[model samples]
Target: MIKSVLFDLDGTLLPLNQDDFAREYLTHIGAKVAQVIDPKKFVSQLLASTDVMVRNKDKTKTNQQVFLEDFLHKIGVAREILLPVIDEFYETDFVLVKSITRRAAAARQAIMAVIECGLDVVVATNPIFPASAVRQRLAWAGVDDINFKLITSYEQSHFCKPHVEYYLEIAAHLGRLPAECLMVGNDVKEDLAAARIGMTTYLVTDCLLNVKNAVINTDYQGTLQELAQTIAQIIKER
Candidate 1:
């Protein structure tokens, strides 16, 4: 039985021009941290740190730790001086970037379907941001303020998506085997990677991110608005 659903955020639940979202996020975050470090330098170093998080292989260190270790090393800033600034930025300024995202009421309904069936739900967004930022984005998507049983964040994660290990980590965290979970997302590359670990997949194609044009096999496929119906049908059949 599929005991849990893993949902990706960026192009799945939240419709967005991913490029614009990243640009706006970096711009505002750069401005916010400028008081402690040069804005240009901060942005560059932050990206470098994020890269570290993405390539992280050390299960012993969280993505956040990997990011901070490289970030603080590159910029020579003490963690005490930088963490609060970034945390405050996520708490206050990050919400402004929500303007770049288009909302979908069906996204919430889809989540509700999973919840109604009593299946555990995990927000399997790439753990590239802080938990606070993740919660805020979930709010913007009308997901009832972090209703997911688990929200992957850099602080609690060791791997980023498109890596099978990332999906495996989530399965382990949820105490479910890969075959017992369903991964729902719009990205052909990242979201589909879950299948490599034996999880079933539902491809949300409205804002699909299949840049490589890879042929994918999805157990179910539809747009975000079609998701609730899909889940309902799945449950009925089950």
Candidate 2:
């Protein structure tokens, strides 16, 4: 039986177009840091650095390390100077980007229902951001940080989603097998990828991204309301 539910944040529980949200986030932070560096070049360098971090293979290397290393390499600046600048962006500029997201009452209800069913809850958002950023986003979704048993963050995670090892790591951390977990997200590529290790998947179609064009084959798919109803029915049946 499924005893836990893992959820993605941006496009899944939080209703926002990933591309538009990302563009707004980068633009907002870019404007703030532009006073110290060229805005356009800063955005370009930051994105390039992020790309490098996403592709990094060293499991021991934190996402922050990967991003910082690549960013510092491009700017040719001392690591000490860059830390304060990045800190300023996350602390101040990042808060403004929350306006792009929409809150769903049903999403919160769905999460509550899962908890009531005696299932463990995990905010399995991609471990690209630090815990503070993840906590901020959770607030946007009407989910309190304390609601989840564990929230994935760069400091505690070594792998990114779509990698089976990432799911395996979480499973091991929770002392549960993959088959006893339910993976829920709006992205076909990232969320559905957990199925390879035996976790059942529920695709939230409202903000779906079928990057690999794989959603057509998934049996469990629906909008947030529909998902809430499905979960309710499952609990009733149980």
Candidate 3:
């Protein structure tokens, strides 16, 4: 029996255009740190550091450590000097990014459905953002009120999405075999990768994000409304 359900944030639970979200996010953060660092240089180094985090496979360092190590090195700033500013931005200015995101009622319904079935719910968004930022997005999605089994963040994760290791880490955290967890998301590549480790998958198609036009091979595919009902049906049959 499935013991847990993993939900992706960006196009899955939270309705958003990934490109637009990233652009607005960078714009807001860029303005916040403009006084000390040039926005262009800051954005460049940030992207490069994010890439470093993406390619990171060294389980010893969390994605946050890898990102900061490369980011601070290239940006030529001390952690003490820059971290507070970024933290403050997430606390204050990051809310503006919500304007680009739409609230999905089905998201909360789907999560609640999973919870009511006594299954653990995980917000398995790509672990490239600080927890504060991820939580903010969760709030914007209207699903932050409930407790989660795990919320993948750069501080806690060593790998990013589309990497099989990321799924392994989450599975290890939940102490559930991959087969006992159901991966649900909108991305053809990132979220569906969980199937490689024996997990089942449900592709949320309301905001489908198959950018590469890859063939869909998920065990299931449907909109968020259907997902909630599907979970109910799955439990009933069990």
In model 2, where do residues sit more than 4 Å from their true spots? 235-238
Better of 1 and 2 by TM-score: 1
What clash count does candidate 2 reach? 0
> Which 10-residue span in candidate 1 carries the lowest summed lDDT?
229-238
| Model 1 error, position 46 (Å) | 1.1
Whichever of 1 and 3 has more lDDT, that candidate is 3
Model 1 C-alpha lDDT per residue in residues 1-238, reported as the tens digit of each score: 7899999998888888788998999999999998898899999888888887898888999998888788888897788998899889987899889999978998988998898888999999999988888888888888846467889998889999888999999998889999889899999889988988899899998888888889978888998888887796765553
Q: Which parts of model 1 have CA positions greater than 4 angstroms off?
A: 235-238
Against the unseen true structure, what C-alpha lDDT does each candidate score? 0.87, 0.82, 0.91
Question: In candidate 2, how many Å is residue 78 off?
Answer: 2.1
Candidate structures ordered by TM-score, highest first: 3, 1, 2
* Residue pairs whose backbone atoms clash in candidate 3: none
Candidate 2 residue 168 C-alpha distance from true site, Å = 1.3
